[model samples]
Target: MRSVGKQLDITIHRPEELSVPLRRAWHEAMDESPDYANPFLAPEFAAGIGRHRGGAQVAVLYEGREPVGFFPYERNSFGVGRAIGLGLSDCQALVHRPGVVWDMQELLRACGLSVLEFDHLVDEQKPFGRFVTGTFASPVVDLKDGAGAYADWLRSTYPGVAKTTLKKERRLGRDVGDVRFVFDERDPRMLHRLMEWKSAQYRRTGRMDRFSRPWIVDLVDHFFQVREEHFTGVLSVLYAGDRPVAAHFGPRSRTVFAAWFTTYDPELRYYSPGLMMHLHMAHAAGGHGVRLMDFGRGDKEYKDWLKTRELRVGEGFATRPHPVAAAHRLWRRPVRGLRNTVLAHPALREPADRLLKSVGTLRTSGRTGLERPAPRTR
Candidate 1:
């Protein structure tokens, strides 16, 4: 038995190997902690990642007969570990009961990891706070009665936005066909289209195209097939007549709808379809009982306009005393520091953005034969 301090028993298992009672306990922990409400923190998401990632593991912390916490991570052969689905997952958390804290060194030892790396860690994780190297603002929209309620809030929050958006919607319908918004589209074809748009968007922005990887593609498809109440793959589309102008695919817990993969047709950029889709999505999601829409962590003008508030998230490496841990932190910290510096300074960021666009133009010309700037999917 792997026993940690505070009389906790730690058991490591593949996520799929978790017993029904343990999964239920995991769900209960999520319900008990507001910070763990993100779908990324759920056992279902860990299980999904485990299906695709061979290294995926979950450590269940038990106090006698009761399970009290769940830690999901991916461990490599060198004893290095990372929060499961690190790059793609917008939220990273150790779901646990209130007041239940673990010793970092003991936890890492129990899991057979020298270091645990994470980004987008929820702020309320007090045990991990000391390890945090940086913190960022994660914007979110508070939902209420329905779309109409949000529209009013948006109008008041961003003066003249409602009028401008309405005018654009009218023009779009007139130019195209009757505009339509689907909150939970089930069509496989539409999902494929969204991935295509997202891939092109990444290429056009000089960003790594995640969909280009087979495993990433398969993971997305797997998520699309998931239909649990605690975790559902939601595909929202904004259609101009029979043609889809913009689409978004993301997971939602019962109350939180995370804004994930979103992309729009390049030709429809003039209508600002990306922004339009977001507005409509908020309305529909609110009507569907969603109380919060998390925009993830990013510094975008649209997030500033659309958000009701911001949640703080952290990035860091939680390490035990080990040579491997030291080496891993040394190699990774500088890279993260430089990138954060570039992103934090506008003078540096603008020039970098322009350079990316210029490179994007050349790449798009040589690759996709489609070359034009479109609004980003926030």
Candidate 2:
């Protein structure tokens, strides 16, 4: 344990080593701060990631032996760290008691990280705000009265949007089968199908397939078994009669439902099944008491059409001096910049997207050929 000031002590522990009392305090702090109440920041999430990810650790901040703050991260051998579940977790912050203050740089040094990178940091993290390179709009649906109220509002506010979506849903039902939705599905088979469809979508779009990583695959598989009061693995699906057409897998807290991994069968793309899935999820989840549906940071037409409002999130590096940190930023920042550029401009984005699809075709086809090989040579 290291003392930051006369009043605070910071101790680092592996994720599994987080004590029960400490876990309770962490949740209490989350409940206290709307910024940190996301289920991704929950101790249960940290524990779940820790079970599969070896580098996972949490820094406990205590004031006179009472836990006051919790910062969870994944550290690599080179002392580079990232927000836990960085890529998938939309909300990132140090859960802390109100009025707790500490030096951010000192905290990084104590954790032995030369640089800490985050893409979806909560805007209230003022101590680290200066380090932000950019901020993005993270759209969300304010489900104040759940989905039913939202539907009524949608009809009144965006009648065209509501009408178009309803029309498409009806067509999907008529063309495929009666459209039915399951908000919190328990079947593991659906989970597998979700992963498979997501992987195919990644390849189809020339994006890196997250499911290709064994750790990620294992993590989702494990999450399927997790059921808790503060956090639960929610697998939602839209079915055409008995056949699944669209599916989403994400974790949810009691009040916040995160819109994480969502994918649908390519065959059903023409009917706009993905949009249908979100609509049903919003209604079902809100009815169950979820006050918000965070759509995460990204620019997508569908999100814009569905969102009630937008929240600010940040992307940047919080670093201490080290050659490794410098090198990492130098190598990584431009890639991020270029992607952001393309995403921001439709003139460039459309061509780039087409180019990526062409490349994806070649890549997947080549891999498929190698995997199948030609018939045995005579």
**Per-candidate clash tally:** 1, 0
Clashing pairs in 2: none
Task: State each model's C-alpha RMSD to the native.
Answer: 3.6, 4.0
Model 1: per-residue Cα lDDT over 1-378, one tens digit each: 599996898989999789999988998988887788888888889999999899999999988978999999999999999999999899998899998878888999999999999989999888897899999999999987574554475576456578898788889999998888899999978888898898888877877778777777778888899998778889999999999999999999988999999899999899999889888888888888989999999888878889999999999999988999999999999999998999899999999998887777777778655443432221
TM agreement with the true structure for every prediction: 0.94, 0.93
Error of 2 at 196 (Å): 0.8
Give the per-residue lDDT of model 2 (tens digit) for 8-100: 889998877887888888889988877876788888888888998889999999899788999999999999899998887898888899999
TM-score of 2: 0.93
Candidate 1 segments exceeding 4 Å error: 147-159, 367-378
lDDT of 2 at 128: 91
Top TM-score hit: 1
